[model samples]
Target: MGASGSARPAPFLRIAQLLRDRVTSGMWSVGDQLPSRAALSAEFGVGDNVVRRAQEALIEEGLLEGRAGSGTFVRAPRERRVLRRTVSGTTSPAPAGFTGTWEARSIAKVPAGPETAFRLGIGDDGMCVLTTYEFFTDSRPVLLATSWEPMAVTGGSAVVLPEGGPLAGAGVITRMRHLGIAITRVVEVPRPIRLNRDQAHLLGLATGAQATFIERTHYADGRAVETADWVVPSELWDITYTIAAPPPGT
Candidate 1:
C-alpha cells in the first residue's frame, strides 16, 4: 500500500486474474502449454507456491489441464448447443463434422422397480421395456442413457422397441406421437454425481470423476409415458435448453 496508498490483491488471486484475462483474450490458445511454475514465479516476483495456487485455480475453472510428465496447457472449451424438443421431433444439433450416434439395446418385459414405477405412475409389479443407450460423438463414447417405458403403453405397438421399426433412433416424443400419445411436456432434474466403475469404463473417465446426471420424464396428456436417466461426462459436453416465453395477456 506504499506506492499509491492502495492495498494490492492477494498474490495468487492477482496472478489468477491475470491468467484468466489472458485466456479470455486468446493470448493462450487451446492446448497451448503455460509457462512453468518456476518461470512464472520468477516473472511475477512470487514464490513457487503462489504460482502453483494460481494454476490450480485456473485448472478448476476448466481453463487449463495438467498432464503427467508434461505441463499445464489450455483446454478447449466444450461445444454448447440447445436441445430443441418440438411437435415435429426432438433434435440436438452438433457442430459440423461431429456426428452424434448411439448404440442401444432393449430388454423387454422387465419388472419395474419401486422408483421407476412411481415415476411412470404404474404399479410396482408392472413390467417395463428397458433400453440402455451409449452415445458417441466423432467415434468416441461420450454419453450414457437408460430409458424405461411401461409395457402397458407400448407393449403391443410396432414401436415397442425404442431402437426398432421405421421410427428407429427417433426420440420418445416422436415415437409416442406416432402411437397417438402426444407428449406435451418433459421435466428434467439435473444433478452432479461421480462416475461409477461401469460408467467410468464406458466413458473412459477416471473412477469417481465428476459427471452430470439428469433424470427426465415425458408427460402426455397428464400421463407419464417414459422416464430416462442421462449421464454425461462434464468435460465432454455442455447441455443447454431454450424455452420460449409466453406473450403478455396469454
Candidate 2:
C-alpha cells in the first residue's frame, strides 16, 4: 500500500511487467532460465503465488516457456503472419517472407445442411460443394478452413470442382468470373473461440486454446453464392483487412 492509501497495481501484474522489461531489454536471453519463484518473490517482496502468476502470464504470451522437470526459460520470438483481404473482394496470399503451404480436399454434390443453406440463402434441400483446407508454416500447422458454394451457381460449368479442372486452386472470385458470375462484395465477421479437440489436433494447438473464428460470405448482384468459416490459431497468425472508400457524390 502507498502512503496516500490509493490502490496499487496487482503484485502479479507488476512482477509480470518487470519480467517483461528484462526480456525486452536483453537482460534475459532466449533459452535462459528465469530466476526461481522463491528468488523472484523475495526480490519483489511478494508471495510465491504472485511470482507463479506472473510467470504463467508470460508463458501464455509466448515470452516464457516451462519445461517439465526443468525450470522456466525464455522463449524465442514468434513469427506472426498476416492474412490480408482487400476491398476488391480479393484475398492476397501470405507475404513473401512467410513460408507456408496449404493442402485442401474438396467434395462436390453434398447436401447443404440447414445452417449452410441459411448462409447461402438457398433451400435446405439444395446441394453444394465443400472444401477443407489446412495450412502449415515452417512445418507447424496453423490454420484450418472449410468453404461451401451452392451447386446452383456453378453446376454443369467448367468450375464445378473447386480443386479440379483448369480453374483448380483458383480462388472463388476468379472461378466465378470464368463462369460469368461477377462477385462485387464480401462480408466478414470474426469472433473469438476456443479450439475444439479436433481443431486442436489438426492445428497442433492445445485444446481450449484461444483462436479466431471468421464467417465470410461472397455476393454477386446481392445474391449469396458462397460462404466459408476459417479457424485460425491466434498465436500463429495476425489478420488484417483493407477497405476502399466510396467515390464522391454518393
Candidate 2 Cα misplacement greater than 4 A, ranges: 1-77, 87-99
* Cα lDDT, model 1, residue 58: 78
Evaluate residue 142 in candidate 1 and report its C-alpha lDDT on the 0 to 100 scale.
Answer: 71
Q: Report, for all candidates in order, the number of backbone clashes.
A: 0, 0
Q: Estimate TM-scores for all models.
A: 0.65, 0.67
What TM-score would you give candidate 2 relative to the actual structure?
A: 0.67
Provide the RMSD of all predictions against the true structure, rounded to 1 decimal: 7.8, 6.8
lDDT of 1 by residue, 23-119 (tens): 8898989989999999989888999998877876676566876555577788776454334323233632111233678789999999999999999
lDDT of 2 at 92: 26
Per-residue lDDT of 85-108 in model 2, one digit per residue for the tens?
554534322222335777888898
| Cα displacement (Å) at residue 24, model 1 | 23
Would you give me the overall lDDT of model 1? Answer: 0.78
Each prediction's Cα lDDT score?
Answer: 0.78, 0.80
